[model samples]
Target: MGEQVSKQATIVGMLWTGGTPKAKEVEENMASYFNVLQGFLLYFYGSTVGAGPTLSSNLHQSVMQVVNSSFNLMKDSVSSYGSRSKDQKVAVPVLVGKVWEACSGLKKAPATNIAAIGRAMTQVAVSMKDVLREMRELKPDSGGQEDDQQTSGGVAGDGDGNEDDDDDVGDMGNDLSPEEMKVAELAMEVVSDLLLVIKELIRSITGLLKMEKADTSGSFVDSLEKLLKSSQVIGAQIDELGACLYPPQEVSTMEAALKKISSSLNGIESEVEDLKGSTDTFVKACSGLRGSIKQLELVLSCCSVGQLEEQLTNTSLSH
Candidate 1:
């Protein structure tokens, strides 16, 4: 598993730094990386529970490093392809979707490793947010200087004769192409899905931390601290996503969903903070915590789908 992960990471790094590869090549590398990630996640889920603490910890760290590197490579690809063809530009969001698919498998990751997985997912979410911002800024090529000159000359000559017609044409030109809008929508959906995953993982770790058996040793306390730190990182990532470059009107639904997730995370943080070395109180709280998280995840999922549908409707209407 380690060898496979190393090889996959190397492929992603090469693709990221190496000059623009063919879209097919990028897709293949992303698929390969996803395969390796799935294998690692399955192994961790099936066997990590029985492994000793040292071994489990090592495995968790190794997997987290690989996930972080892979997502960084995806982000680099998005930035690196800024001047490339549309195909290459679109490939990044597709790769991001694949990464999200891989991350969804982490719901089955070992309880002990949930914190590490959450941290890695947070890194990926942050990078995706950056890519989404870049995508939103994309403007279709307006031909060249000649085209600009022609447009300006036409507008100048029109004066009051055809001013409204020129204004409508200009508006049409500035509107995002269908493909570009699709890419933006894809990026937003992937970011939203990742947030859901992070929320669930944190909630899972919190529940485990509050278990009676979990407090038998110092390890539980250590895990709780790690969860707290990871939660903070996720909270910051959520804030960044909420502050995306899109106009507030466009992202209002997403922002509202993020705000709800942020509140849930804060509540979890408070629960962790109020731990007074008592197992009974922790157990009582754990009973309802998972349910609350599930409710939030459902709400987030619905909001994301609605936002995407609304965007699609607007895009179609503009066309």
Candidate 2:
């Protein structure tokens, strides 16, 4: 059973790495034009309705182009992944971000503009640090340092019980040298940046919904609707990530983090929905104000000079 489990893990790892070669090629393409295109899409979205036929068609085309091109580029590169150099492995996180961005339309989503991409790049860095941490956990003892702690009556084993499982050991590959540790530290910085950007996106969408309510009555309804839908998509992605990172037994911390994000998403969702009724109230208020203004204009227009003067004087005296 142990051997079988190890084999299964091996297979899974192979499957994960299988896409790496193509990942590298597509990422190379992304480095040159993806960021620029992302900028244009963001500008266009900010200026136009994300709901219209033209913008929707363009968005769909851009997404499909990126996805199809990336998949085609990655096809020949999968199986020879591990044999690739360290530099190549290091690029994996960035490539992963690009692929996800394309598939999710996160790049064009108002919540995840170019700024968010910058932040995601930072998370990619922390993810790399996680890679190094795994490596350190697998390091061999130098000299007789910290004599290998063994089970009471069993062969001296690494903390993990899988003795002789070379595949498992390699999966824990690489103790961080001092320099590698620095790289990991840098990666953490990136994760922080990414989180901040995501937060900002949430805030931006919330602000837009607020504005929509204030202007053009319920004209902003469709924008709010799209915002809610986009937010839910993001919430789902975050939940997926939380699940992947946390095992059932150790899920509390991950759950807490996810709950915070979900709460923010729900709050914004509620705010957007409230605008449906609020927009109508604003419209009525504006209509009443217009009537009052027209009445004042007529009263002033029909007033005699002395009567208008007396009226102004009376109004001032009342104040």
Candidate 3:
């Protein structure tokens, strides 16, 4: 399967990059390539999967959801064959990469129902952690110009040597006013608190997973699926929040993210009573998240009012 996926990814890259096995020929063979890959997935997801495999139903369904998304992306690429956009050329390779991930993911997918849900939520937490780390790199826009090599972290200079890379993220703390930097710091706090929510949420999931003879019944599996779906919802809203956390903070988007996060948290919390051995840690995390949101909103409102007053004062002086 890996070799097959490698061939597909390589071919797609070649097709878009004008490599061997001309695009027209590969275009004709695209369906066969897709079928070969789809067959592997079907072998796993089909009746053979139920031939006394340790993989739970939840694992099968979760894998299908992501694999289906990869299929849709590939279909779009095929449909736009002759007129691939520049972005599509770049993305087509990546979309193929996701198929590779979906297939490779089977080995990593948890066999136990509760643990499968835990694994899914953990992936979300890892993503949230990445956003939090990047948010740390964000410094208030000093209207500074960076060359191609220099990044938000700092310039690639102070090079001791390639063999012994110093590899320090540039701390430009002195570049911005404390007042300006505080907005980013507050945003970071929100991200930090959200991570706490994920941490607590994962604890609940793993707790349920650890129960002696964990549930495999349909109704229980349905509830777990709902939790995974809610986690995905929270994960998406976090992405939105991360995008808006930069300078000139997007208050409306941030507020909308908060609203959605609250709703998702409510859904997550609803399962607490039903999940055996789960604790109230998520409840406490939710409270902490609310506090962080309120703090960030305070700064946003202060900045908005300050801007309005400055404009009003400028108008009075002009009059």
Candidate 4:
């Protein structure tokens, strides 16, 4: 079974590293790649309890390798097709973002060393952010000459009177204008940053859980409190990122949807705060009960059975 799993993982890795294709092909490849990732994630979830830690760790590393390779392949495709038609150019990065989103389930796998997985995911997020920044930087400048050429080319194509040929030429020349590319790049950056913040939040929460499990002196509580605070901050960041992606003037529906999400996040934050307070109260109550029990045990140790029976009867009468 292990051998078969390894073989399957190897095949998927190959598909990710497959040479750059056109925009549509890139999207298809990414979909297949993420499907394989999802499969491995589910396999790990089912097998983690019985699997050795070393084996699970190795499997995780292999999956991350594929993820990183896929990310790089996406970056290359985006750069290569940056001058392609607006739809094609935009599709590559959007697909990449979706692939990252799909992998968000990795943190939930029941593994012994989730910290390692979280670190790997953080690296992937960082890579994605870098790619977005690169895309923004690659946004082309305004070109009066290019526009003039397009106008002349349109007239020339019409004169040829072959509609099919004209269509082909038009498609080739439909590359995004500078302003449009800038908008697309900015949108992609916001999406990528949102994903990054979410990944970081996941990593921090995983770390917090590990600390809590290993704690004996309640040191983890402070870290847990800090993590909750950080979660609130990240939630706010997500709201800002959403606003950047969907401005109120241009996409009112999206803006309304984002507002709903922001509200939900706020609700979650309040719940986390309430949970923290409840936990502290429970711990203090347990401590007090333990101390009272210890005192009662000391007092009872000095009494014989007859004396204890008399004391109990007197106390009941007084009550």
The most accurate candidate by TM-score is: 3
Worst 10 residues of 3 by lDDT: 47-56
Candidate 2 Cα misplacement greater than 4 A, ranges: 1-164, 210-319
lDDT of 2 by residue, 1-319 (tens): 1122223223323444645445555445435334444554465456444233323444556555554534432432243354456555544444544444454453453332222323343343345445434423433323223224334313534355555458646633344323223333332332333344334444444445445435554345444444444444434444443333311112233334334444544554445455443344333433443343334234324553345557767988999
lDDT (Cα, 0-100) at 250 in candidate 1: 38
TM for every model, in the order presented, reads 0.28, 0.24, 0.54, 0.30
RMSD of each: 18.4, 26.4, 13.0, 27.1
**Candidate 2 colliding pairs, count:** 7
**Candidate 3 wrongly placed segments (more than 4 Å):** 1-107, 141-180, 210-217, 301-319
In candidate 1, what are the lDDT values of residues 18-89, reduced to their tens digit? 566777887787788778878877976676653444336656765675577567656657565546566665
For candidate 2, the lDDT comes to 0.41
Tens digit of per-residue lDDT, candidate 3, span 183-253: 66876787788888878877776666444254434556666677778888988988888787554456778
lDDT of each: 0.54, 0.41, 0.65, 0.46
lDDT of 1 at 217: 57
Query: How close to the true structure is residue 67 of candidate 4, measured as C-alpha lDDT?
Result: 60
RMSD of 1: 18.4
On lDDT, the stronger of 1 and 4 is 1
Displacement of the residue 110 alpha carbon in candidate 3, Å: 1.5
The best candidate in terms of lDDT:
3
Sort order, lDDT high to low? 3, 1, 4, 2
Question: Clashing pairs in model 3?
Answer: none
